[model samples]
Target: MSRNHAVLTALAFLASVLLPAAASAKDSSYGFDTDRDRFGWAIMSGGNSTTSDVEDQEALDKLKEEYGGDDFLFLREGDDRYVIRDRALIERAQRAVKPVNEAGRELGEAVSEQVHLALGTSKDARERARLGRSIGRLSREIARAARRGDDTEDLERDRDKLQRQLDDMEESSRDQRVTVREKTKTKTRSEEASRHLKQATHHLQDTMHDILHDAKARHLAEPMR
Candidate 1:
């Protein structure tokens, strides 16, 4: 096959094997992000170290070792460093993640079931009010847990202050009464259920963040799109 055809085909296979949603998406930032992640670089972050001449090659080598590639695909740029172009692996090992993926799905489903059960059986307005606040706090925490990128000293301080404020709000909210209008809500969830849902969401995002991070994609690739 031609080089371009091979590249496309290889990428397609990898995307399908690694991230099912990516291979099927017509237009999705998630899919594109998945591609960028698989390459161990973000197309959004611009940096000289992220160039194919150095950064990408380092990522490629790690993948080669991880996937048991028989032949290397790179050109030497300097002493022991390479410019990676074609990431086509000659003899690639199949990634063994079916059992792990199935387990994750099963755990998610179990959590959903448990949360539904809790929501179904409980009807404490005070508890529901508390659950609402907990959910809101968890939503914010989920966002924080999923946040990426380097933080400046000022940003770190700001985040710490914001976290303190959130903690204060959560603590003070415990004493606040839910009005009649709030108690008459058609839908309400128990604290257990709310906590389960929010925790599960947070866990999922954390897992994704860890995956991209552990891929050694600490920087972006140059000529980012």
Candidate 2:
């Protein structure tokens, strides 16, 4: 063959040798880009980090069999950050929101029960005083939870205000008890004590209602479901 023809033939042989490898690399690089395949990739990557290469590849193959098809893309955007073309982040955010929302709901219910207990029965001054003290303790718990940012700031403020109201109710109950004791023989003293008891009960109910409302609002704003 002429020198030019020989050179051209050698170039053709080199091209044939290198082209398949280049094509294979390109195919491997863009392999998968679907949700199921991406999930499999994540599982495989996790398993491989701890297991032998044989075990890792076996796990990956099993996942591929269970899921079928390589149609997913596992894109690592940053450290501990991954992008799934699925609703993974939304599902994660929902999971995180659940417990906090449930806590708010439970707190609201407890506050409501305390309110009902305080208001449902008419009691003597001393009994009312005890109920008011209980209500005050519940309010403090609610305030602490709110301050910890488990709920809203408005919730914390409402709890603090309710605590103050409960404190006032307790003091009023004690005063009514003292006044009744001082005038035990008087006929009007019984009526006066009843009036004070009713007032304390009403105050307790109102404070509890405020606390429940605040909690419900916070819960509704960020529902677990």
Q: Highest TM-score among the candidates is held by which one?
A: 2
Judged by whole-model lDDT over C-alpha atoms, candidate 1 comes out at: 0.30
RMSD of 1: 16.7
Q: What C-alpha RMSD separates each model from the true structure?
A: 16.7, 32.0
lDDT of 1 by residue, 1-225 (tens): 233443343334323323323222321112112123333221111111111112354455454554353333222122232222222210110111223233333333332222222121123323332333333333223222222221224433443454344334434554434333432231232223324433443343344345333333533111211
The C-alpha stretches of model 1 lying farther than 4 A from their native spots are: 1-94, 97-100, 125-225
Task: Give candidate 1's TM-score.
Answer: 0.24
lDDT of 2 at 51: 12
For every model in order, what is the number of clashing pairs?
0, 6
lDDT per residue for candidate 2 within 147-181, as digits (tens), equals 22233345446544654554455445533332333
Best by the lDDT measure: 2
